[model samples]
Target: MLLLGAATVSAAGQTPEAPKQAPTFRSGLDVIAVDVQVIDRSGAPVAGLGPEKFTVTINGRPRRVLSAELVESRSATSMTAVERAAATAGPPVVPTLPRVVFIAIDCLSFDASASRHVIDSARAFIDRLPPTDEVGLFAYPYGPKINPTTDHAAVSRNLATVVGQRHVPLTQFHLRPAEIVDLSAASSSANARDSSLLESVVVRECGDTPDDTCRRGLMLEITGAALYYEGQGNAGLGMLRSLLEQLTGITGRKTLVLLSAGMIASDTPGGRPDISELGMQVGKEAARSNTSVYTLFLDTTTTDKFQAQVRGADKNLQAVGRDSEILGRWLDQFSGEAGGAVFRVQVGSGEYAFNRILNEISAYYLLGVEPGEEDRDGRTHEIKVKTKEKNVVLRGRRWVMVPKRGAAAAGTVSPAPGPAESASAAPPAPPRRVVPADIQAMADAFDRGAAEFQRGLAGTRDLANLLRNFRGSETPWPNAPRRTAVFALELAVAALRSDNQNARDEGGRLLAEYNVRLRQPGDADAFECAWLWTEVTALEGLFMPDSAMLLVPAAIERCPREARLHLAHAIISEQRWLRGTAGAAEVPGILERYQAAVTFSETAAEARMRAAWFLFRAGRLDEALALVETRPPSGTDPYVLYLTDLVRGQILRGRGRFDEAAKAYRDALATWPNAQSARVALMTLLLSRGDRQEAAKLAAAVETAPADQFDPWWTYWLGDYRAYSSIVAKLREMTQ
Candidate 1:
């Protein structure tokens, strides 16, 4: 067991001359926990065994039993001491619970019909789980999202949602015969080579089809299925491996139930390597984490005879075929090595299999073996446990990877104070105020990171780290406390956008406390306005418009001269207008706010561009044109300029001037070549003007755009690329 403590400093009612020592925050050593299960000859769980009844050996050396206890449903303990320590901003230490279950629906490998059945069974099992047991749901291969909950109603509803949706594997493996449209389109390229290769193989080897069309179709189907199966299997294995590694931090009965037919393989050795290496990796992680892997084979394929025939045909065509025994053996390797069992679900009995696995996890014995001097070395050690009683059996993890950082003994005391913090203390240090330059530097850094994120040059983890560096207590910025608050608000908004639940919860709590600070007396009006601005921005991102609108009037009143405050008001108006809850009369108020926002700001190009678009959309052409023509010659912000040109092109297109509208869009592209919105708008314009060749070229250019470049607005309404996708699909069909 690890002993953890924190040192804190208090200055309440202290004299200025009084001496005080700085607080020291130290990290705790790592502690490893293992889960053990004992059973009788008849396979019934053997309970009531105390710590003294068993002897534990680590690497052939006997160790003391720190604590041995049985964890059962309905009597779960509250958060552990380690859990509370991990809650603070520090190195993450995952705490073990009584039970943790992850139901990974193998949507990538399973077809829609099979996935539907699996979802139904998963829902039923969730409804019957003990209220104390924690569970998370995941769609495998895609690594969608994990929603951990104990709420049966919510879990059931989520499971239903999973059933209603179809998950296509997004693994980066392209197997589809590049859309063959009129052979003439790609005849002079690599398509000619691939077609020739395919024809020779099909006609010479199989000769089962009579015509080129039939043979081509058959070969394409066989090759696509093989590549798709191999890709999905590899992706699923990678995700499962990651899950096991994460579970190492937890201490209880962690169980992962994979619902799928099994891992697929190709008969060609080079097509798919033997998956034993992956299985071994899973076993090591499971043993280290004391977790279990339960593979529930869904038998999704058809009857044995039909499946055999299909496999045979696949073998002849692509030198690949389904091998159930190979898949089953690998599953057994993982489960048995992890002290778990594999179950094949009988026809229409998926619910039964799920319940059986749940029962096994609900009641398990937890064994805590204190590490010896030799066990402290960072190495894998084999664990052996024996019961003194007769006619009894034992099942638990066979080995564990000892943590490099060993914990202190359970009953150790704190050491004596050092010279600096002794009885003859030094004089109190002067309080330091936050530096003004530091605040500006931090804000600039944040702005740079945010811009990079907008341009798809930065990732979510990078943004998260940037925010943490600014807000945490460890940072050197001693002055500008309000700036940190604003950074926290930005972090919250980013978390919500990225669907990071933990960051969202923590940031929400901090921002809520700032709300309390907002009403306190003696605060600067500027700070209050900035706080309100951050709050309104977060609310808008969360789609809580009513709450956001309620704060606008107070914010405008607090900082009447602040341009951003007025822009916030205009944004709220635009939200209401788009929602149809406000009438066209609100447009004038929006226009006034936008105009005021531009007049009183250093740079409000975005506001001006938005106002122009609003007027153009509302059919006030003259007013919109006047505002657009007044856009200051050029600006550094390509995004803003892109939006300006886009709005201008839309207005010009609305006036039936195709040539000028196309030129406006081309000008936007010149400003920012990667501006996806400009390309998409131009494509549509070209299509309308019967310029299919130009339109097709543009569509092809963007079809290969980096996935990250299309994000931050990738969602339907906000992302311009959504329109690009729809137009491209239409163009493809029309040309075909």
Candidate 2:
């Protein structure tokens, strides 16, 4: 029986343009390419297969084969003169396509020695590949990434940095025999039993005889362990999915070799989803991108008798054995489901396993099969292949993703709608332009100074040290006057906070020089002037509100049509009035500026949300409600919708409308579930209404969520800090 793994391929010599409209189903015939490896009884690759020697089927229906070509690569030392002559004796080889491969190292799972062995094996594999092959690198759990290229030396350099970065498991609590037996006997679907087992473990580990305080401490520790494992699993999966998405635009077959000790499938209940569900999602993504996942399972067990003896003395031998078994099973299932196989590498056998993997990927037959109209419905379909030739075995992917008919003509993968797509349904911002070296250096210096200020180390000496770099012998860019003024304002604020009179006077003099230059004709553009105004207004509001009140009117006069300047003026005026630095007479002017900002901005959705927030804070509930009542159009920015709903919920809750407030919070979560503000607000409301059980569940979910989840509320009050770096890069691009 042929064990065929199915893969889809695009036709050679066809470069289809992107489709301009939504694709229709069953518009034309599409040829699906499959990669099949054929090996003899001695496990040597079988070559020279023709189109007439193979048969193919889709959903159990026979299909005609259009072409068959044997693809192989070998090092110069491995091929003999006779083999070379036979290779050239066939039809002309396909030269336009090159193989793409990625090596992903799971740094969070491998120990120091295991990592070293894996790196050595990977380097050997790269050395055997031909020069035309493209290679990429990715280190899991927030490590470095290099895109696909033919530079073998660069990949080797990056591999050296992966050592000693693995995470050590929690060893504070050891499970007793009873606890392990109870967990082993519980059904996988029994979530309640799993929760009870976890609580029991905490109780047993508290003390020989427990008290309330000891139990609380043990609970916190176990909770932290659960959160750590859950976060690592999700993050690893997310990174893998992102890498596959990036490869979708590249043509031809792609392979991803993942090297790791193992991933924790599930250590505790309610912490993470089951492995089957996650594996299925990943497998589908791989099929869509025409990529196969190969896993190199590195054994992490120690050979040192000293470490083994210590583990045995602590009575953790059984627990360690159980964890290893679970991890092994997880790796096996995940790799097989993603249309690839696993190669287990014990001590001293790393090279052998990698050599076996290389043999399979180095040579295969690319077969083109025609599918029926019903099969082209933009979904993944199972496939089968068989050969008339005897005494050989076939191995390849079992499924192929069939694009919609029009998409097949365009030679692109049309992604199916999923949760990630729904969350980011809005149009993305423009990509950042490349910045000049001088501007990048200045930005880096500014970032360092900001970091120092955040750490309470921004003394007079530190401010002078940071400013000295910008002071002398640096050729100025086109917008030098405004840029220098912004820097001077930052230094001045730091000096004021430190109560350093000399440093403050120096900063004031620098600012006066730049301010005069900025006011001169043709020294700065309208955009630069507006940017300087916004920066000055934000700094003064935080440190000295009186100064902002005096300068904002002059700023508005200089850039009368700039909506951002109007927004900044409104924000500062409201802040001053709230702090009692300005009287109630300024309230009307603040309201007028808010209205003007909304009217003049192209991003009116965001502007309206900000204005509604101001109204909400000022206790004008009716006006706030009116501002947010009109729902934004579909395909609007997701961030704007999220903030609008969050602010609306706050306004409704303040008016004693509990039901409406809860609905609004839910709406906000549906848009961006990773955000924490809406979830916290909803949990608080549940607690206030005597729904302790539901509130507790919400709190637990929030505690276990990934730590890197973004909450937009944290940056709402700061003026454009989220996009400040990208804005500066744009300024540098313009000047250069």
Candidate 3:
């Protein structure tokens, strides 16, 4: 959405004369701009190519090339005096398009040494990049990220910090002397290979004829390792995909340099789904965002004595080699699909790989191709560019995402008009509105009241008084004023929470009025009604479970594609059932809603945790454990980790897995040591198991913890209300 432009103007003392015609430059879904790099035999950029020399195709059909301009970087301008003189005699140079590049380091994938090498190479690449290029940095799997900027030094400094921060352990899985085995027959499948290797090691350690206990241990270890790698792969891909989605909003082509040892992309038998599918999804997203992914595959193999001794030296080397090959193939496919190249970075070869990448990206061609109607189906289409010039090579994106018909028109900027076009063009149309002025005024007042409540400057009494005289909109606003409805519901909840009788009365009255309005023909927006119904039902259920139950089905009918609404429905239904107002018949529906929320909301960790809690409460220990064991969204959010562990601990305890439950509780405390709920839970569990000493230590530690420390578990049932202040602030900003 960031648009950069230039205009030629007259001197300050004189009146500016306008041009004869509008600038011919055009962009959008109508004109697909494909960045093509045409290099000669020597790897030098070949310039001055006209549209006639280039042929472009989309989905195997030829497309007309509207224009072809060479976007050369400043570093690529080096030439002999004779060549420079020849260029001066040719067409004028086009200004370079702003280059946006991101260096993403997968901290979890590399070892400490490999990480340092990746950092050094990235730093060197940044140093050699043209100053005009904006560079960014992302240390993946919950590491720091710097937004794209021209400050290369800042990016380099950030890159340098990732050297020693690699998550790769010196020893991933330890094998005893008896566990040593040849893994030559291991399946090529990444997950299968790991399973095979781990199972073999575990079996050998258990003796030639393993017992039931040893067999159980083998299964547990193999399953645990698979889950760990699967989680890691998902986290890495999730982060990458998130970055690509963010880049989709920015204008121009972007370059993503991924520095990783490897990513696990294969599926485990009857276990986790194929992570390779997610990897391909990431590739598609990168293409959709017009990003080229250049992968720098770091070699993570090590020769430490301990690793070799645990697994036979030959077996160790073989496993590492096989892993590298599998991972390397994935990297190649990932990069190639996104119209980029991969370079294998061995020790001392980082600089060379980076240099080649820099050279490839230094200069390129931007071809404006007129897409066919079919190409505008809001899907990525295969694009190929070729030139008739001899002894030359062409490199461009293999896929381009064409915006859906009528979608590109939104927020698109047309080229500046010249004097003649400006004088003849019609005036712009007036803005449209569905909501009446009075409704907007009410919404604005509620926003101000919410702000006041947030600042502790006033209560909701004034807002209640204002709404006391006001009924529903005079004219049916329908979907209009959703923000106003949300504001009203928020204020109503605040009033209901207050001690004042008048405030509570006003809140009840406002809810009644809106409830009537919502039922009126053409007066309700599906999404707005869904939200209001869910909130109102929850609020009413606080005192009147029967009335809330009456409104549940209507709310479900109006609910749109929103995870929060489904979550709210599930919570309210559960609450009503718990109060004995609803029967067991509703339990299935409640669980269904929870499952829907989880299915629809990939990043909703709280939803997953709550769903797990609900299942645990229902004594579905296995399902609850499975839900909580899945990796929470990739982040450094202490509360999410804490909550995940807490829920897992509760589930495990319910299943009588006391040791694992204690460990889970301790892990939760590690994330938030002052978390009283987790500490108390752990202490209670330990005490019941006769571990009085640790229980006493835990109980004593609570007194020394900070009084102001907040335990997220206390408000776990409040759902999103835990973030009420921030949510209100965000709503205010959004409405404004």
On TM-score, the leading prediction is: 3
lDDT of all the models against the reference? 0.54, 0.60, 0.61
Candidate 3, residue 353: the lDDT equals: 76
TM-score of 3: 0.50
Ranking by lDDT: 3, 2, 1
Model with the higher TM-score, candidate 1 or 2: 2
Give the TM-scores of the predictions, in the order they appear. Answer: 0.41, 0.47, 0.50
**Stretch of 10 with least lDDT, candidate 2:** 1-10
Off by over 4 Å in 3: 1-30, 40-43, 75-77, 80-93, 164-205, 267-273, 302-318, 387-393, 404-736
- The model with the greater lDDT, 2 or 3, is 3
- Give per-residue CA lDDT, model 2, range 15-67, as digits (tens): 43332222222223456667677766544666667778899887788887766
Better of 1 and 3 by lDDT: 3
lDDT of 1: 0.54
Ranking by TM-score: 3, 2, 1
Question: What is residue 198's positional error in candidate 2, in angstroms?
Answer: 7.9
TM-score of 2: 0.47
State the lDDT of candidate 1 residue by residue for 1-736, as single tens digits.
Answer: 0111111112223223322222222322223455666666554445566667778888888876554555443222222445333332332222223367778765544555556676788888877776656677776544344645566676677667653122232211122211111122223245554765444445543465535443433333343333333333444565566566566544335677777666544222333323555566566667666666678876543333244223332232122223444345557767766766678774356876776665555445555566675676666788777767578666677776565554432111122244344325532332222334433455556545545433441244554444433332222323544544445555555654555644543444344334432333323464566566556655654554433453466566657776766776776667666765445556788788788778864437767777878899899876776676644465446666766777788888888888978988898888777568888999999998899999999998889787667421123123222233342233223222
